[model samples]
Each structure stands twice: as structure tokens, then as C-alpha cells.
Target: MIKFAFCYEHDDTLSFVKNEVQNCLRQREIEISVLCCHNACELAQRAHSGCPDILFCDLEQDDATLRSAIMNVKRANNRLICVSTAASHSAHAEDILLEPLYRMPALNRKHLWRYAALAYEKILDEPASFTYYVRPSYLRVPVHEIRYFASEGRRTHIISADCRDTFYQKLDVVEDLMRHKNCRFMRIHKSYLVNASFIAGFSRDYVLLTTGERLRISKYEYYQMLTNQLKSLKNTKLRYHPSYSEW
Candidate 1:
């Protein structure tokens, strides 16, 4: 569910904007909560407490003060999508906001609905492509091309299909970063992190990659992996063969 906070100066247009946004989200079967704030300070306070997914603010007020308040709110919650509504604004305001500003004469259902749809797309869509920056020349390497990472002293070697690159980074730090960013790297050993997508098979103490590379795996981790694989295969079989229940 997406939560939205609306900060506008005019009291009369508040209901209109709220209803339009609600209706737009309802049509898409998305649940949302909307909070209305009369001023920037109120908006910032609400954002600091609720950490809303999106914030819509009126930009017709004192530009300097409003921008500063918005920046504070953004700093408090980096994930909040801050949007500005203004009929006209100076280039300086645009630079300050940094995000796209909606310019409309009056708040209407159609325009607000379009903006809501756009926000949904921007936040929810995930791209399949992944890249890692190699140091020195700083070349962008596609993550899918890499098979595994092996720790060699202070430097980590990236084994890829085409070429190998060496970078100075801890294995654990790279594993955490990749996992947080939705990469398929899994740490199966103390000194190695293998991409799960490229894993062809596994045994008691080793993992076989699609490239025919055998990587060492701890006995405990290998058992854990085997259990997880069995559970997954059982679930798949149950889903496909409902009547054949014998495991």
C-alpha cells in the first residue's frame, strides 16, 4: 500500500485533490492512505512521523522557506517522493526541487490521476539489468556476466564469463550490498560468494557452476542449501501434481 501526504495552502481545493487521488488509486486496486497538511511545517512533521511514500506540496508560497522545509523533510525520509504543484515557477525553484513539478492552473481529477499513475510506475517498476562499477578505469560490468566472487587476501576477484576483474573490497561487504540491491549472490563459503542464478548443481561440500567451476562450500551451508532446494522442489511438485501426494 502507498501512503500519501498532501500539503496545500488553499483549503477549498484540498477535498478535490484528495478525492481525485483516492479514486485514481482505487481504480488500479491499490490501497492508500492520505494525510492533509495546511503548511510546510505540518507536512514535514507528518512526514517525519509517518514516513509517507509520497508527498505533494504547494509551491506558490515563499519559495525559499518552502524549499528549505521540503529539503528537511527529504533528509528525514530519503524514500519519500516529494512533488511540487505550481502554475508557474522560477528556474531556481525547479533546481531546488530537483524532482518533476506539475504545472496546472487548477487542481483537477484528470491531471492528478495521471500523476498518481506515474508515481506508481516510477516506484514499483524494477528493471532486470544490473551493473557493477570496476575501479581504476571504472568500467560498468553487467552483473549477469559474473559467475562468482573469490576472496584473495585484500582483493576480491570477480570471475565472469568473458573476463576477470580484481577489486579491493571485503567479501562480506560485497555480499551484503549485492543482497540488499536484489542481486542473486549467495555466500556459501567463507571466502566465496556465488551467483545463485549460475549455480548448476551442488554436493555435500562443493557447488558446481554453469561454467563447470567447482567452488568449495562449508558442510553446514551445503546441508542448509540442500534442505532449501528439497523444500522448493516439493512445493513445485505439489503445485503441479495435486493428486499425487506421496513424497
Candidate 2:
């Protein structure tokens, strides 16, 4: 279920944004489990009380408290996907926030759908489940919960924060599907495909995921590529681990 909250200073802009968001989700066929509409001050009062899973807000609005409040919630919850509706250059500054779904001049349907599609992929909704079959029956697992996929012999194991599932599949097949799905994953080794959000730290030979598990990097070239990728990212607004070697 995806709970969406909207915040904006202007009433017309808020309504338009809400409408666009609904349309985008409908196009993706993702149902909004909980919908909230709020102005800057109203959201500021309850931003920390219970933050939504996804937030669409005007970061460039003339409200510092609202911006700071939303940002604080984002810092506290790494799973939360916040998309900005601001079109100005200042709102897209490096220090503002790490946004994945927002595009400049995003007041239209097409851009909004792209953002919604991203949110849909990341949401813990049932429709975004990763499916596997065992004979005649099929099991579905929420894509967001999956931490990694590993192959052992001819069977593939799916690891999530909640559970582990094993099924007959190839890691290569899983990797290919995940890439086409635009999932937040990286192939650190031939046998392992890890969720990018679960990654906590990095060293030359291994990646330390947030689940307190370390996965080995198979090759020096792959390690370097991942290191470069991590350096170019601000997804977590994080600094690399102090032990991380430049090489």
C-alpha cells in the first residue's frame, strides 16, 4: 500500500499537483492506500507525527519550516521517496536534497507519471510484487522488502529484511529482470545482486549492507566501478565509510 501526502503553498498548485498525482498512479494502476492533502503550515505541525511513505511537495515554496520539516523526516526514513514539484534552479541545488523522481518543468502529466512510476516501483505495495512459481502455485513478495538475490548451484535465494525465499532460477536471469525493471540494485558479484538502498558501507573487497551482512566484491574492476558509482551518488546523503580506500 502506498500512502501519499501532498504539500504546497498555493491552493491551485496543490490541487493541480494532487490531480496529476492521482492520474499518474491510476495510469500505473497503483491504488493509494492513504491520501493526505495539506498546506505548508498544516504539514509542518504533523510532519514528524507520522510521515507518509511518499511525499510530493514544493521544496521552493516560501516556507523554510516546511522544507526543513520534510527534509528531517526524509533523513530519518531512508525508505521514504520525496519528489519535488519545484521548477526553479535553486530548489535543485546539491545541498537541498537527494531526489530521484523529480524533473524540471514537471507540472505536466508525462513527467508526473515518470515520478509516479518510480514511486510505484519503490512502494511496499502488493502490485509491485516479485513473483516466483513453485509448480502450479505462485508466491509474491513485495519488491521493496527484498534486500538481495543470490544464486547457489541452480537455485536462487531471495533475501529480504523480513524473510528468505529460495526458488529455482538463475542469478543472471534475476539480474537481467531487475535491470529492466529499473530497480535500485547493483551486481557486486556474479552470484549476488544487492539492493542499493540496503547498502550501508563499502570497502575494496566487500559491500556492507544495512542488514549487517557483508557481500564480497568479485573483481577489482567491478569494485572500482561500484566505488565510482557510490561517489557520484547522494541517495542517502551519506559520506563513504571512513575505512573505504580510494583505490
Candidate 3:
């Protein structure tokens, strides 16, 4: 069973998103454990003990929760992926509420399908990390933990969460490695190669991230490519088969 945590500050919004997430998983016949916490740090602590897989939240209300939760998970050396009720966000009264990756774009009710896709992708038992050489030992990070890769002069920075690690490498080499693993990343600028799934939305001048940070868009081709890829996520296929009993 996959484990999911929803840390929230409001109730109605939480219910809406949770129900949608549940429906999406039910369609795929995947079993999940749902944990609700108000404070993300506590959520992370419990998640660490349980090796939790996914986190869902309302970004507007849970920024503090999300920040602390991310830190706790990081300190425990675990990965936490959040699904917010922002990809295609809509202003809703307390009466209405709802709910990942590339397809979400803003935290609107209509984007939960893409959210499910991200959740399933994270749960799949595939090779899920990127490895970079670090002298005697290498750093292996789960692909989802990576936010973006930036190349500055002679060094490259692997930025994730709130931390940045620098190493000697070229952006082209990193892009090649991502492609080799079938990881979907897009180059919005010559210096920034971003994970497509983390893309919130974009304007002609900038690409917005779920984290509320903006990166400049240089090449229109990559932006167009990313748009096409996100459109395709709507057709994302989900597969899982349970064993049959031999009597």
C-alpha cells in the first residue's frame, strides 16, 4: 500500500482535495494510507518513521506547514512530494475546495487527474534517483527531490528544497543524464533546466513554479515543447495488476 499525507489548516478545502485524490486512486485500484496533520513537521516525523511516499496540501494555507514538513523530511533523509489544491488554482469560498506535477499548473479542482498521475509515477517501483559523482562517494537523490539544475560559469548547482549543492559539470551533461533515465525535464533558459512536473505555469517572459518562484524563459521552443508535453499528461496511462489465485 502507498502512504499519503495531507497536512491542512482548513477543513472544507482539505476534504475536497482528499476526495478527489481518493477517487483518482480508486480508479487505478491502488490502495493508500491517508494521514492528516496540521503541522508539516509532525507529518514529516511520522512520515519518516513510516517511510511515507506522498504529501498533499493547500499551498496558500500551508506554506509554513509545507516548509517545516519539507525540512523535517530532509533532516530524516526522506523525500516528500506535495499535491496542492494550486496547479490551476481558483478562488473558492469555504464552501468549495479541491486538488501534482506537469499537468497541475495551478491548484484548481479540475487538475486532480494530473495529480493522480504524479502520485502513481512516484509510487512505481522503477529506478527513481539521479546520481552525481562526489569523489569517494556519490550523491544519489530521488528524481522528485530535484527542483532545477543551474549552470554558472565553471560549476553546476543541483538545487532542491531550500539548499543548493555545487559540483563541476556542464548543463548539457546533466540534461543527457536526465534523458537517459526518461526523466522529463525542460530547458526554459540556457542556464536553467527545470523538471517539467514542477512547472506551475508560464508567461511569455517567465515560468512560474509551484514554489512561487519564477525563472526567466529564454527559448520559445522549449516552452512550446513543455506545453505540448503537459497537454499529453491528460492522456497519461495508469497500469496495475493484482495476482490471481490458483485453486
RMSD values, in order shown: 16.7, 10.9, 19.1
- The per-residue C-alpha lDDT of model 1 at residue 144 equals 61
Candidate 2 lDDT over residue span 25-75, tens digit each: 665455685445566567656655666778887665556666667667677
lDDT of 3: 0.62
Tell me the lDDT of model 2 at 234: 47
Q: How many clashes does the backbone of model 3 have?
A: 11
* Tens-digit per-residue lDDT, 1-247, candidate 3: 6777776666776676678788877765656888777666667667766745677765555354466555565445444455654433444342122111222456555577556545555444245577664444446677666788999975788988756788756787677667644346778788998876667777766877767788887877866776676566556531211111111
Error of 3 at 26 (Å): 0.8
Poorest stretch of ten by lDDT in candidate 2: 238-247
> Global lDDT of each model?
0.63, 0.67, 0.62
- What is the TM-score of candidate 1? 0.48
In candidate 1, stretches whose alpha carbon ends up further than 4 angstroms from where it belongs are 93-97, 100-106, 127-247
Residue-by-residue lDDT tens digits, candidate 1, 1-247: 6788777777777777777888877775667888888776777677766766676767655566667767776666665575556545455634445453444445677668866655654444333333333432224455566688899886888888788888756687567556533335667787888776677677667777767788877768655864474445444422121111111
